[model samples]
Target: MSKKLRLSSLIVGDAQADRVVPPTGFTARLTLFAAGAMAFLTVFALALSLASGRLAARWGAELAQSSTLRISAPAEQVGAQTAAALAVLESTPGVASARALSAEEQRGLLAPWFGPDLPIDSLPIPQLVEIVETEEGYDVAGLRLRLQAEVPGAVLDDHTRWRRPLERAAARLRLLGLVSIGLIGAAIAAMITLAANAALAANSQVISVLRLIGAQDHYIASAFVRRFTLRALSGAFVGTAIGALAIFLMPSAQEDGGFLTGLGFEGAGWFSLLLIPIVAAVVAYFATGSAARRTLSELT
Candidate 1:
């Protein structure tokens, strides 16, 4: 109990021992640069993860509860089939709304491929009807049966093939982003550990003198731990702030950047990122303390 109290005091309460040890410029810069760089990369990784999640939710919400009906009958029958499909959809229990695409809308959809001048009336293009599902989506099998009976030429496109792949890709991207954050954290810990070890080796004489003066291992270790901890916190804070600003400066989602361009933090994500500096400081504290104690244990 007494040992733990003394150790705690040495780590956070006392400062004389820290002043006794001269700071090494090289290790100081190394720690600052490493922590800053790692924090910057971590911010991006976090953004990627958050953005991917948003994309997945958006795609699922937009595509999951809707279906398309295509009527490819002869030109004479197209109008009748489209009307029949819309009527069936309107009468369907789980369908919220259904509308047949206008001539202008269909032409606009085809203009991308066939050029603006392509005559819509001349082409025997299939008529398209968009169907929106209610809170309880339509039963696919039942809808298929109704369509087959009422409109032989109408085909349902549930968008399942398209949606599944996009959702899976977004999920994978999110997973990759999380893995990247973990790697950045591990890299930061490793570099800080190496820096701490180097500082310990450089201050061997100081350690010897302090030990001879009746200092405990925790007291000796605290000096290095506190220095690295503060350095990491300061560096990480600056890095995170800079990163956040960079993200803020990015083109807005309204710019039509699709998936990758929309990468950035949302409401609560910003709050979570604020914890990076604290996490870096904690990691540095433990890493430096462990290195210090291990190095001190090997001394004569």
Candidate 2:
């Protein structure tokens, strides 16, 4: 006959071992509070990273597929050169559509820096036209050569020189946010380990009774793991909720021009935010279990 497995043969040894759980040992309640604070900060860091990534993708997509043509001939030849440039762009295979910006539109574009009325027409300003392209974009080298040969004083600015720097800055911000989350996670694990060791040291007498009664190593580890994991889960839950609320209460994109003001989770990104507490709890479980087993093994 096959041997039967006894689920009820409790490995905890002493049935009353539950009564020995101490209130103050390793991580004080203060440790949980600190962990919660760190988790909260991590939530914001994650949101910032995600938002910045989205912004970078949007900016890159917009700028990559667009180009600008500047017509800088004498006032008399301005119209002729602009027309010639438009004709060339229209004939170009990659170009989608070329548009010479209207005077009012030009004024609006400059209004942010120079105020509404800056004597736009009276000054000898170059004519500017916008070129929208297909997904493959256009051949800037070839187009510039064509413009130079056919339209004197014409220059093409695809905005690449300046756009690349903005993309890099956004990318760096994203990396910073990710690094912050990693550091926060590490801190949480360290705190849990310390807390478990403290609890084990404080309850030395309880551990002695449990071991004297034949408690398995797994049972001793479980006591510490269960307590620490529960604490971390609860703390992280409250922190995540508070962090999410704080982001929601902050000024939105419609209210602020500064990008920092609107930094937050958006759309389906909020769903991923829910995973933080679960991860914190899992980390605490493993950290506390390992610490307890190692410390107990020394005594054994």
Candidate 3:
């Protein structure tokens, strides 16, 4: 920005000869490679955060309007308690449907723990009824009170005891993923700064010669800044494209045991992912630019 530097940037040199402080060389390539690698990793992390966020929302929504009624009475009274609980649920304004599990269905559920051949009929297992609620959701407290009076052996479980904590844990995982992305960006900035500083240090003699020939700091800095910024921008785009493709190629929800498939973004989120290149470019611009200006100012 100094007048001395302005004169140097526009000072025409040899028309056919190569540039004095020519475009970045090996260092730029290495820096770009590093940046790209980091960006690619960050994209996956971002996808994980976004996917987790979606999963948490869905799980929270699905658990909100459902409850389970358990009848733990003696064998003689289980059927009566289950029927009474179902009757109460069906009569409630917010209740959509209430149905007691059939014997086969109950046995199938218990089979997971009792093995495939357990005699469920002989076990002192409680009978369970599934309750579905409408949009407003049922008043669980009131429903419990009603169940206690007419079906003393029935217990209402709104699924809140475990649902809320699961949701919070999912949400926290999403936040942690986002924080990881932020740290990656910060690391990129720091790496770029170091590379820029090294480039500046290496070109001290060239800078002095340019200044001696009526060149300014801006000209010298612009050359380095433009090269680094472009490299970062290009590398980031390539990385983002690769990263997005990787996420796109991930298995569907039904595949890969529900782990890798859930590690990417969906829908319009890809557009946001594309912005990472621009952000990387901007970071490079500021980092390289600031470092150049400060270093040059100290000399001339």
Q: lDDT of each prediction vs. the true structure?
A: 0.88, 0.82, 0.81
Model 1 Cα RMSD, 1 decimal: 3.5
Question: Which numbered prediction scores highest in lDDT against the true structure?
Answer: 1
Candidate 1, residues 118-191: lDDT per residue as tens digits? 98899889999988899888899999999999999999998988999999999999999999988888888888
- Model 1: residue 69 alpha-carbon error in angstroms: 1.2
Off by over 4 Å in 3: 1-20, 74-80, 91-93, 112-125, 205-222, 251-256
> Superposing every Cα of model 3 onto the true structure, what RMSD results?
5.1
Q: Which pairs clash in the backbone of model 2?
A: 26-198, 26-199, 27-195
lDDT of 1: 0.88
Clashing pairs in 3: 8-216
Worst 10 residues of 3 by lDDT: 9-18
> Candidate order by TM-score, highest to lowest?
1, 2, 3
| Better TM-score candidate (1, 3) | 1
Model 2: per-residue lDDT, tens digit, 257-284?
Answer: 5678659888998987788888898788
- Residue 72 alpha-carbon offset, candidate 2, angstroms: 2.8
Minimum summed lDDT over a 10-residue window in model 1 is located at 6-15
RMSD of each: 3.5, 4.9, 5.1
Winner on lDDT between 1 and 2 is: 1
In candidate 2, residue 95 scores what lDDT? Answer: 94
